[model samples]
Target: MSLEQDVATARQALEALDRACASVTKHVGETVDARRLRGDLSRVRDDLDLMAGQQSYSAYEPFAGVYGDGDDEGFGGAGRTGR
Candidate 1:
């Protein structure tokens, strides 16, 4: 199949996986493992969304300032610079 077809198939599979995850969550309360799994699934779905253009790349975008020059320090800036 073509690349577009493969992406479509993967999207559908992700949708089905989402439904299954929901069903499992409903049947069994959101245990620790279940919550962790859900979090992981959410991240995967977000990635798929980014691939499908359903979501923007803003979250993954690079910071607009330097790291130690009193800038935003990107994402992992602890207590070194600006917020």
Candidate 2:
């Protein structure tokens, strides 16, 4: 129900999926489909890592600054201007 709990559940699910993929690859010998599945799994894992990291920040971290203050860039806030 909480963010931490949800993240933990997702991570467990991803780990299980990773193990299953490994087993399939071991038996199937890296076929195209197997490779695709592995790639997708890797991307999903990366996404999960990112989400977990973001969620670990304190609640105020996201809103502590407005207008792209040096302390917080706001994670893709429109206040950012490309050099």
Best candidate (score: lDDT)? 2
lDDT of 1 at 66: 38
Candidate 1: where is the Cα deviation over 4 Å? 49-83
Q: How do the predictions measure up, each by TM-score?
A: 0.55, 0.55
Model 1, 1-83: lDDT tens digits are 87667778987898899888888888889799789988777777677677766754535645444333555545766566544
Output the number of the TM-score-best candidate: 2
| Cα RMSD for predicted model 2 | 9.4
Give the worst 10-residue stretch by lDDT in candidate 1.
59-68
